[model samples]
Target: MTNETEVDVIDPVAQIESYTKKDFQLTRLPYDFLYGLRNNKFQYSQMQVVMADKASKEGVKSFKQLYKDYLATYHSDEQMLAVNYTEFDGQPFQLACGSYICHDDIALLNSNGIVEEICNHPVLPCVRLVNIDDNTEKLIIKYRKGYKWREITVDKEILASASKITSLAKYGIAVNSENAKGLVKYLTDIEDLNYNEIEEKNSVSRLGWINNHGFSPYVDGLVFDGEENFRTLFNSVKIKGQIENWIEIIKPIRAEKNICSRIMLAASFASVLVNPCDCLPFFVHLWGGTEAGKTVALMLATSVWADPTMGAYIRTFNSTAVAQELTASFVNSLPLVYDELQILKDKKSFDDMIYKLCEGIGRDRGAKNGGVQKIATWKNCILTSGEFPISSEKSGGGAVNRIIEIDCKDKKIFTNPSELVSEIKQNYGCAGAIFVKWLQQGDNIETVKHLRKDFYKKLVADSDVTDKQAMSASLILTADKLINEIFFNDDILLSVSEMQSILTTRASVDQNRRCYEFINDFVAVNYNKFNPEKDGYNGEIYGTVIEDRIYFIKSKFDAVLQENGFNAKAFLSWAVENKVAFTAEGRSSLTKRICGKVCRCVCVLSVEETAEDQLLNNEDLPFD
Candidate 1:
């Protein structure tokens, strides 16, 4: 039935023998041949003859009838043949079906072995099934297009192969009609089940999911798991000097016994979660003095998310605009930690940008025209420093309502953080594990509310005006959350009590003055009285009314007099020299009269006023 191959004499024999060895056994057919089999109609004479002969032997009227009979014969019982298929590279053998075959067995094979690899079936083809060690229950399947034999123990797919085989036979091509249907169905079923499992496994993979810069989709060279214990997460301490003091800084905050304080903290966290993106964009203002371990606490906060590189830390004085631009690329990660935010100029422009970047939708102007383009909505968190709670430009809106404050200054008052940071750095991984566990234990909003309530209960006695203000905001934000938690109640909309509580508290006059220093400067340089076209007061000119000899000094007197060529210095000198009811205190009062009289003189005798005087006195202009 097969031809024997000579080891050396015949040139054709040597070539054929080498080709038949292991490498070319299943691969002798060219790639184009397989391609043709898959894409072209299967109507070749060779397949028709085989089907005709099989049909005649079985006394069937058609090829379809013969295939049905073949399948019926092997429907209940089937045997799996064990074979080692190998590929040869010059002389070295690559494992094929599971091992090496002698040269003698290679020569006896006809038309090569294993036709499935070269077949074009809609269903995934199998090359060989190996027992794979003592585990005969799990078979190693070498699929047609796959790189290696996969181990499988499921039989649901194997049991459903009968129908698929019958369908393939009607079209042509050679098939072991006896077992093709059962084999094809089993393979298909297994593939579907296997894919579903893979998807589920990958869904819960949290590695590199949380970070400081934002949320990274992928991270390298890091081990992540929420279950790791504390002892295993840290490293050995180099106990000495400032390094010894770092751990001391973190102790009190870490060992907080009051549940209310943590609830407030959780409520702060929930404010962000109310609209948290995968990136978690939110800002937390942690204001305090030095040695408070504010920096160390920030580091601990990041540990909960795992990986410091995921977050970026910048001092308050840095250009916030540039900071926003740089972090834009990584917004999908986690929170952007703005350290020492107090250094930024307390102006509306700078603060507003930060405000919008935190809770408002970030937007930019289009390059060609000034078209408004909204940036991708990100959930990045914000952390900054300030002595007092900042007010939002648009108060009472949900955006500003989400911000929560923590009084870290009080807790870290006497504590030293030098040693705590050293310990935390060494055991960063351990800290992260603990933080994750803490988050999973309760509803985050409720947890934060408790913290805030307990904190106020403790400080109700000596709380300063600043603390009271921040507490009120926290309470309002909490009440909003509680309203949602308890189901929307009609009481939320009926009263001005909530609004009055937040609006009534005014900052101290000294504090207000300091707070608006930047705004006042902006106003002074650019303020103006109403200009119909310009929509506000024209700040450039001091308002002046000119009529006859008296002038109404609505604004800058010096500039107004000088523009009229009145020899403002000479007039002041004359008024003083003549003692014409004039005094240093009377200058403004007299100036107003001088401006008003000049205005009236121009109205009654327009020809008497010079061109410069007409231009200088806008009060007489018809447009005014």
Candidate 2:
């Protein structure tokens, strides 16, 4: 009996093999026909709705119109026929001729069979379809910079890939997999094929990709050597029944297609943080109630990374070295997990440092010199939690867009986390193997999207939510990359309130403030970084944190009251006047109110003493 449900599995080649040698004729369909059919299937029909939405956006319309306008302007330039550009092969090619207003008898430009070549291919039909506009004449001629134009239908896919590739390439990661998309499509077409086998094979291949792109291992203390030993450690366990359960947790029942999830697992395996430059300052947030597995999710993510031994460093209410170390480590990779950040007293300076490290320009000189001599301005992802969003007092500049958030709501610990960890390591082959499979599956992450969206919907429906800091920074970054890859052209409105609400719910107000005071003390000890440009000025930098009124750090303000100098009490008074409230701890009651008020005394400015005056009137006072 012939089973119609059976999927035809073939080698990498796009050939349809029979179930049995006697099942069908040896050569009924031509190879080229099968190959083209596989490439141009309607399997992505579900994706078309999204594609049409993107094409209908206002910015997309503007882009198309702009190109049309540019082309129309060229039509009037009689002197020019068309513009010319070189192909990838470096051959001179003429673009639409332009107006040679200054000088030129004939249009002295080389014209290849480019125009005819373009009118007949995917670049014209499928790729260029995205350039569709209400005005057809203006739309067709606007995009004139290519030997082969992409088809609109397929162009959407290619453009999405191109944009992602370009963004990554800027950071020096080039993907030369010409048929990578086609290959993925073909492989996925096989039904009933063991997905695990495919995932493992692909995971290994993705690891090699990291090394190929010049990303060295041990970024931020995480190491990924692509060692066979680690691979064995990952594949030792089994996910047999758990797969179906996990799939159920992902809402919508059906997984959405996206590229971010693929990269997450793959990059995690390679121990390479996928920093998509196009989405600068990506924001990832974990929000939900307590015991929701937010921390566990972060741990899982970190463990899967190439190396988790030094993947993070936890700081306390008063730790200077930890802050410096985190700032310096961000340059290469690894997330700076600021645990229990809500317990500190000072928040201003601490938040300022975090903001800059997350989004501001690269660290100051010597920032990357991770040793004692290093400066503090390197980039990094910060993970923390409290009851509210980190405020400006605790935030240096602003929350970087690169920050990603995840929700760990309702996550229970019925299963032993250690056991799960062991199982993952032994059976799944760890990050290197898992991620390789994800990458081999190509950049499709509809599954993750559906999961996230379902979670969001559930939260909207529920009222008893807790643990707002359930999401991890990595989760947000992964989401952003996926959104960009899947809905690059879609005009979706994002709510700032949603972002702020989630962040505020996680940060601690007092602990965040104390972080500021610590920075102030460090600067006081090392004053060269903030010396005033004046003489006879005695002002000490005051660091204080407000209570639940605000979360996170504010800024470093100067206290002008000069007492026993460095008076903690008097400084607190000044803070009150400026609306900054904080308590001084571990100081004498008298000093507590005027802490470190004077950093430099007026007498520090010694004008050159006149020799004659000093000789006649100067007398050394004997010390008691």
lDDT of 1 by residue, 156-233 (tens): 323245543454343343246665653454455334434433211111112213433222222222222111222122
Give per-candidate clash totals: 89, 122
CA lDDT, candidate 1, residue 549: 26
Which parts of model 2 have CA positions greater than 4 angstroms off?
1-213, 218-276, 281-294, 306-331, 342-345, 360-380, 385-397, 400-429, 432-624
Local error of candidate 1 at 434, Å?
5.3
TM-score of each: 0.36, 0.29
Error of 2 at 57 (Å): 94
* CA shift of 342, model 2, Å: 4.2
Could you give candidate 2's per-residue lDDT for residues 1-624 as a string of tens digits?
212122133322222222222212242222222222222234222222232234344223232222223323433333223321111111122222222111111111213211111111111110111111111111111111234322111212332343332332232222235533422232222111222222111112012223333222211222222223233322222232243232233212113222222222222322222332221222233444565444443444444332222223222335464444434343233344444445556654444544555452444444232444334332334444333334433232234222444344444422345554444333221433333345335444445544444444444343222222222323343443443343232323223234334443322323322332443344445453234323554664232222222111122222322211233344344434333333334321112211334322111111123622332232321110
